[model samples]
Target: MNTRNEYIYEFGDFCVDAVNHLLLRRGRPVPLKPKAFDTLLILVKNRGRVIEKDELMELLWADTFVEEANLSQNIYELRKALGESAREPYYIENVPKRGYRFVGEVKESVVAKHADKVEEDSDKTIKSLAVLPFKPLITEERDEFLEIGIADTLITGLSGIGQIIVRPISAIRKYADSSQDPLAAGREMKVDAVLEGSIQKSGDRLRVNVRLLSVRDESTIWADKFDENFTDIFTLQDSISEKVAAALSLKLTSEGRLRLTKRHTENAEVHQLFLKCRYYWHKWTPESWQKSIEYGSQAVSLDPTHAPSYSWMGASYCTLGIFGIVSPKKAFTKAKELVEKALSLDPTLSEAHEVLGAIKLFYEWDLASVADSLKRAIELNPSNATARDLYALYLTAIGQTDAAVSEVKQALEVDPLSLIINTDVGYILYFARRYRQAAEQLQKTLELDPYFAHARYALSFVYLQEELFDEAIEEINKAVTFSGRDAASSAELGYAYAVAGRSSEARKVLSELEKQSKHGYVDPYHIALVYIGLDDKNHAFKWLDKAYSERSREVIYLKANPVCDPLRSDPRYADLLRRVGLP
Candidate 1:
């Protein structure tokens, strides 16, 4: 087939220049996968007409056998690139059982005069790259979660090199189950190259077979096999990242170089325990949190000087506070002690610094200390998304809503698909009293992960603030079902019931909660939320005071919680806020 003259299609600020193979927004190139680009080309070529999804997929895949899911992913990327909506179509319209259609107008410009020059310029080499989550080598009897953790750590380490646009772990996790071609995964993720690997563990040793592939041609750039004891897992992770960075011709900073050589533990058993702890931590559920703590404790017992294990142990305790499963006083104390021990073992541990900051801000109510710790943590590892997200929370607590939002934006840049970070952004918006915006963000998060408990809970809270009692009840019910007797979820469910005039059920639930609290203190802040839902300000304030006295971490949110807005008008509310150091 003869090559036709290339052209540029312009609509609004978006320009798709076929000659250069680039999509530009306001004259600057926007990063997009080649498949996505091809999809866009097809759409623009048939602008104003609906293109069947299968037809488009056939054009994109050509001779390959690809699933419908691949087409859906392409559509998602296309929409994201256009900043368009799936529900309210602006550029592409979903034809339901049919397919998709481009609805936007296009004006094409002849590019035959500059086609060769544009093509030459398009070949500029990428100075830095990231190898996303590689598909597991095999599907049977695989430890998928552990593989993901290893990939995430490697990406994080490589990102610390400062010159690479390392794809976030959350984005890469989407391809964890991929059985397709490695080149296809790389194209989907819009990366220049990909590191594909398979891990096999036998006794205390690990065998990792890895290959670096150039996405453009599916050509192997480098390949290696690493055989190492489990005790050297961290070192192995560092080696992989460092080798990739070197292959890409990127300069590693002194700190990055140090990290590439650092060893957190040399005990194989302890390392295994730490990996198991990470496996559970990634689960992000109440049950998994407990399991993580158990595994972390085992790691500590086996290697008392292991800083990463202690840091993760502290993080597990922090999760307990968030779930209202344990009193903040107890949880934070343990977190503080573990983090301190971690820092004592290795003051440079970024995770320990981050968790310590959270402990200080939410439990101790020490804003200055939180700032210091979070800053140090970020200084140590800028690629730590958890640290950035927690720092954003601290910013929100201190009435720096705009700054907090900016911090979360940076975090999203690193962890684009992180459910927790997305939920955090919604929570920050909620605290900023932007109920509708919060609802929209949380709804987007739910769309991404329908069963995400925290996002559902936050959506319920946003609905309540918007006076959408019925919607709030529905979401709260979902949260309760997903969380299953989680104290925080149950407390919120009780509140939703009370607000919706299900007084009998609310009272019954509250009674059961109180009875359960006879052995352990029920979170006073949660009780206060339920009372506020009942419009019993007096009881709400009473519980709020108790929560303050108990140093409840939930109380840290009093200053910004919309449910507490009614209480905020009362003098006692100010007193409680001040007492919690939140004023």
Candidate 2:
């Protein structure tokens, strides 16, 4: 049997996940004899150097006397498993009278787990906890995102334990200052426990110290320190979550322990790259989203089975499509492929399901599939704020306004200060046609961050729906300015201008959009919106049809958009709604 300390090594299209004793080629598992597999692992671990003939025998068979021919047969069988030979090795290179070496470039990956404790529990005592960001002290790398990501990763692991409600990253984003008291911070977040930690480096060694504080008493319930080499950094992160379970005196099941300890990739650099890129990705700005894709794609290339990295890549593509940064059909197709691959590698990945659901809802026009993926995502990770936020949007689009409101409310609770999430709440209320309440909610959201472009953009839609033309124009102008006059916001500005009866200004902006479309992407839905404001029914229909064919994102809003009421009477509009798979 393989030991728990083993890892998966990938070269070319093949992967060997030693912990699971899995050998996969292009994502499909390959079967191998136990002895043959062990031989492959020893060769893989010492890939650069050729093992001596006698040394290989002793390593494989500790005390037993293995015949020379038995070792030779195992090598032949292992080579067959890899579809290689001693003559021309694509993976293993065999030297005459000497042993073997792995020839191909290898990426080693391992999932860390908790094994020291196996006690069982029937019930959980602690309900909630917030894992605050870890401080990086005496650091050489000087990367803030990497420092914070250690705690964030632990939060994800702890959240996987069914009995606990671990606060999402957004909840602690504002409390990342090293000076903040953990007990006070936990109380502010309304959690029962606070997990605080710091990472300190001494040469190639790392010393991590963690304390779990009870918010109820402002007392440390548990504290521990871990000292290990830098390469074991992921193990330290996993152990923190395990210790949390241990501290609670609640035993974890095998599945729960696995979830708490699993690291997506064994490459520490790739892990850091993923965290830094994800930090920028969550910013939700056009420039930051593009930057995330560049870095996220790099991590995926290094470890194709890295599910979380694939999830990020898919989400970036999906967001770009929605924001008109890329062609929706092209972006959605790529997004679907990536998310599907991510799920294939790890079906429990909640973020990947959310991306897939978004694609189905916005582009594929498959509402049934969309519902399944989104619901499954939430079921797997209830603390996933983005999944809840997205499901809220889907519910709103389909006219389940009350359900939409409830979902967003839950999301907002987890991410109370998130500008985008707060903006979404106002948008959901607006979809329910509670215009006065929607306006107030949006105003509050804007008050939190006056320059939050999405909140301003959402406010414009509410204003236009309420027929407050001047307010619509003002809010859209703010959005346009804040977004650096991006095509989507500029197009909305043109639409609002047309609705306000400023024909000259509206036409000038229309001309700008027309000119820009020649050089960059301009969603057909935006052009349709401008036509709607112009009361150009035929032109509006024309662009809506184009948007539907291109799977334009805003097309999903056809049923909920109050400004499109004029077009709702038309047969083409109903057909467009039908094509979007909305009730």
- Best candidate, TM-score: 2
- In order, candidate lDDTs are 0.76, 0.79
Worst 10 residues of 1 by lDDT: 121-130
Best by lDDT: 2
TM-score of each: 0.72, 0.75
Candidate 1 residue 522 Cα shift, in angstroms, is 1.7
Tens-digit lDDT track of model 2 for 147-232: 67887798788776545667887677777677788888887677778888887777778888888888876778899999988888
Query: What stretches of model 2 exceed 4 Å from their correct place?
Result: 1-125, 139-141, 181-184, 249-251, 486-489
Please, what are the lDDT tens digits per residue for candidate 1 over residues 374-427? 867765666677888998898788776766776786677666677899999999
Off by over 4 Å in 1: 1-153, 165-175, 178-193, 200-207, 213-221, 227-238, 486-489, 501-505
> Quick one: RMSD of model 1?
13.5
Give the C-alpha lDDT of model 1. 0.76
